[model samples]
Target: MSKPVIDIAIGLLLHHGKVLVGWREAKQHQGNKYEFPGGKVESGESPEDACRREIYEEVGIGIKQWYAFDRIQHEYEDIIVYLHLFYAYVPDDLLTLIQQPWTWYHRDQLMQLNFPKANDTILQRLFWSHFIKIGDKLSEFQPHADSLFYWRVDAEQFQRDVLHTYSADDLTKLILNDEHYQQLSDDLKPLIKTLHLKQHQLMQFKKGDLELGKRYIAACHDLVALQHAEQIGCEAVFVSPIQPTQTHPHTKALGWTQLEEWSKQSQVLVFALGGLHPNDLAQAQLHGAYGIAGIRNF
Candidate 1:
């Protein structure tokens, strides 16, 4: 005999920059864990319908807009769970009507909470999505303070000079090239925030090989590459040559207008690359970029 498989639907309610989550009662399964508010799907209930019903029961609010986000299957000691996750948006007025004790958590703050093991995949997705939204707020982003520094230096330089420049807190996320990543010691690997992969490298990489806390960003020149990056589970995409640069002065640039158009169609967060400067942050946001990425100017 096989253990019963329970189908569950959950809602990730977003408002402003925070997400609403509720604490499970100590008596319930996965007790005391912080989770997106939801419940089991009744027989014949559609996942979307179940999500809406559960959200209303748990939070006392009806979701106005929602779409499927991700799905997960996990087997515990006694039961199997098929979790359906959805991203939802609710009106501000409904927030106060929630019956359960709930809290709004910022993306960074969520890292501290202890959620059920099965929720790890969704948690990572949420964190990346939140960070991408934050990247869009260019006026509030401080490169030295908030932005991850992309280090493209040689391994020898990294160990000698670059490593000593800042503490772990000052540079939490460091992006490294594939060669540099391979050269890193096991101890240094954990310190990296993301892996910067070229188009070919990204195509060759496997999603399962990705580390839990680290993110992957790939350089994409066109829509096909962007779609490929998203399919490969890349956290972000860099749409490059937005402006002609000294490195490739002859290459055509995708001006702000086209950049905006492309970004609107992109599935993943799009970063404007090529000939970008620190001052271009605002302009990048206007053109629908998550942020600006550059080799020399940044």
Candidate 2:
């Protein structure tokens, strides 16, 4: 009738390379389909409260804590459904897929899934890429160039808003505080293993001012640093403003062609800045950028 919209809670139950997906009774209209483990929100509940309730009812276990994720607003039929979604990281053994309505699929086995929306990129990104992994033991986080969460804060003040909140006792933070590296709030320092230096902070004393709520990626523009990254032992650099940015409208960006050329000579990892988003990571990689770093996306 009314584009049957429902509040759903999905669980990512992974075990032996398989993830659990659930559906309703095999032949109903919205049935016989696989989705995350969740259901509708009761009349008096908040989405978070509803998500917890729905997961326990459908999967018969509790989610110790869930990360706040996307708010998907989509059109399911003649009407629009604003689905406030979250991700719950549960153990692999917590799942029991003997229920006729449930099945488990691995990352490589997506072709075998029957969910109508699984084909949409949203599902892949939501379940696979977006969730920041937590609760892993120290032995699990093998430090490599791969798992680093790189970000660029607009000098000293910006760090207060973006980097301050995600603190847990264990996460190690590496920041290029530019000129103000010494100015970081003392309370924030004990929580992290801090490394502050001049070369990484090139953008710190740049010509223009930063915009509120808009943070772009950029190469720190220290040719000296580029020559000495190996000697200095640094991993990445931000080269930016390939397009006109509000913060540095006059600072002509070293466009993609130049970035490619520069990248070949520099041993340090490179990222394209200016105006960027999470989706830009792929484009960045193609152009010799190891990853994209920006405050706007984080």
Candidate 3:
């Protein structure tokens, strides 16, 4: 007999650099394990609505806004589950009012807790830092344990120098632009785990054309492209021109409202790019960005 399939909406309530999680009751299916607060998605109910309802029902906190973080499918002995994850930020004042059984754990501390097997993927992803640095010269910036580096240099120079300096493990925190990625040899490809697709590249992209193990992230300027990125298997999208930039001073900025709107509309993580600086990370997060990416301020 086939296992029953279920859809679940999981919320990672983030506040003050921590996530709100609850202990699973001993009578529950996955008893004694810690789980993010959420429940099953009822028939005819959208995952977003399911998440909002479940969060409120389980935690008694109502959230008007949340960003799509990720989706995962896992199978247990008797059932299959499709987990839809969302991220919501709760204010400091509201954090104090949360009831018992819901505990705040620092992002790093989550790894130490015993969670259901299905949560392993999200736990690894949650450990990624919220800042991405984009630039042409890799040597200009010092390496950071938590941050990701996107080296925007030409394909020839990248292939010639990158492998000699960084290992496959090191490349996990690095991102290569699509142009450079396509030019790399098959053997050299595994060294790159993340690809950053430009607007033009994303427009012409076809699924399965890229390597299977790599994570694709796209640069988008509008809602259409952001949706397209999600449709084409992009795990993250960088919505750009959120602020005025020296490189394109005359280009109109999308601003924070548009950023939040697009973030809510897409299923992938959203990064606010273009003219954003390190100091703008908090503001970007408030506007629904998973992080901030920049060429100069990173």
Q: Would you estimate the TM-scores of all the predictions?
A: 0.57, 0.39, 0.62
Cα lDDT tens digits for candidate 1, 1-298: 8999999999888664468888987999989889888889999999889999998888888874565666789999889999987766555678788775888887667777989989987775556421221222223324355455565555455452344454654434455666667776676665556677788877776645555445678888877777677665566778888988997999999889988887766545678888878688889878887677766564
Q: Positional deviation of 269 in candidate 1, in angstroms? A: 1.6
Cα-lDDT of candidate 1:
0.71
Total residue pair clashes for candidate 3: 0
**Pairs with steric clashes in candidate 3:** none
Pick out the ten consecutive residues of candidate 1 with the lowest summed lDDT. Answer: 129-138
Predictions ranked by TM-score, top down?
3, 1, 2
lDDT of 3 by residue, 1-298 (tens): 8899999999888764568889998999899999999999999999999999998888888987666767789999989999988777786567666778898887768889999999997887665567888878877544555678888887556744555576666767888887887777777776777888988899898644544446678889889998887666666778989999999999999999988888777656788999988899899989888888888776
Please give the CA lDDT of all the candidate structures: 0.71, 0.49, 0.80
Ten-residue region with minimum lDDT total, candidate 3? 206-215
Error of 2 at 10 (Å): 3.6
Best by the lDDT measure? 3
lDDT of 1 at 73: 94
Better of 1 and 3 by lDDT: 3
